[model samples]
Target: MSTIVFAFSIFCGWLIFDVVKHRKLTLESLVSSLVIAVVAGVFWWILDLFF
Candidate 1:
């Protein structure tokens, strides 16, 4: 479902950011991760709408 996809994207983004940033948990990474997640979710949503 779209909801699952969105949540998964968010989790993936967070995990990736955390892993790539030397495992350091910072506010900047957290914010950027959320942004990435939202963008990915919206992109997927649009694709779902069209196809």
Candidate 2:
């Protein structure tokens, strides 16, 4: 749970940085990256729990 939260937070920070640097946050990139990050985080959590 902590790992997932941390991963999501890091991804969100990266997204925010990109938005600030580009002066825009495209819907596609935002949604896609968010989804990817969430899925990756979940997987990481599961793996950590098992191993």
Candidate 3:
């Protein structure tokens, strides 16, 4: 369940990031999406461990 949620979050995050960035494939958007995803993953992991 967590895995599925995390993957969905990443996909959603990427979509939002892509829109905000105004580019489908660029270094900045890629980095921003990755960073956001990673942060979200870590946050999810912490939540899973705690709750």
State which candidate has the highest TM-score: 1
Residue-level error in angstroms, candidate 2, position 28: 0.8
Q: Go through the candidates in order and give the C-alpha RMSD of each one to the true structure.
A: 2.4, 2.3, 2.7
Residue 7 displacement (Å), model 2 = 3.7
What is the C-alpha local distance difference test score of each model?
0.75, 0.79, 0.75
Per-residue accuracy of model 1 over 1-51 as CA lDDT, tens digit each: 875678677867786868686777777777777777777877888888898
Q: Rate residue 3 of model 2 by lDDT.
A: 80
Kindly give the stretch of ten consecutive residues in candidate 3 with the minimal lDDT sum: 23-32
Output the number of the lDDT-best candidate: 2
TM-score of each candidate structure, all chains considered together: 0.67, 0.58, 0.65
Put down candidate 3 lDDT per residue, 1-51, tens digits, no spaces.
785579568967796769766855677776777777778877888888899
Residue by residue across 1-51, what tens digits does model 2's lDDT show?
688687788679868877887799898768866876787788788889899
Off by over 4 Å in 2: 17-23
Q: 44 in model 3: Cα distance from truth in Å?
A: 0.3
* Candidate closer to the true structure by lDDT (higher is better), 1 or 2: 2
